[model samples]
Target: DQQVKQNSPSLSVQEGRISILNCDYTNSMFDYFLWYKKYPAEGPTFLISISSIKDKNEDGRFTVFLNKSAKHLSLHIVPSQPGDSAVYFCAARDIPGGGNKLTFGTGTQLKVEL
Candidate 1:
């Protein structure tokens, strides 16, 4: 079964506006959350992350929020630019499981329109 899911398959935002991507998980064993941005032919690159203990984490124009009780998380990009358009995947880590395997969501395609 797919433990992680991105409810929205795609999203469109205007350049210079805020872009919000959402994710939901069915597994409660996840301890860490991460967001990855992938371009056409390139591997997904780390964007921002948050620990389950904390509700929010911010880096530059990106922010990640986690709701442990709800098993939900979101990535926010402020003043989104065209360069930020890509497929974003939400991943969760089961730190207690020993191996560092990450469970990834299906991914959400974000398009920034100019």
Candidate 2:
């Protein structure tokens, strides 16, 4: 069973606009959430993240929000650029389990258009 899921397989946004990617998790054990961006032929790179203690976290043009009640999270990228086009993955860490055990979503392709 996939603990995390990204309902949308792909998303397209105009350059300079906001791109929102969503994710959901079934495991209540997860406490830390992270967003990773991956380009073609490369591993995913850490983008942004949010902790269960906080509802939202922002960094520059990127922000991540977590709703514990809904077991949902989202990543928002403002003023999206062509360079931001890639597959975005949402990952959840099992705080109690420890040892860096994480569950990942399938991913959502984000395409930024000019």
Highest TM-score: give the candidate number. 1
Q: In lDDT terms, how accurate is model 1? A: 0.95
After superposition, the stretches of candidate 2 with alpha carbons farther than 4 Å from their true spots are: none
Which candidate has the highest lDDT of all? 1
| lDDT values, one for every candidate | 0.95, 0.93
List, in order, the clash count of every candidate structure.
0, 0
**Candidate 2 versus the native: TM-score?**
0.96
Residue-wise lDDT of candidate 1 within 1-114, one digit each (tens)?
A: 999999999999999999999999988989888999999999999999899999999999999999998999999999899999999999999977735889999999999999
Prediction 1 TM-score vs. true: 0.97
The clash number for model 2 is 0
Span of ten consecutive residues with least summed lDDT in model 2? 95-104
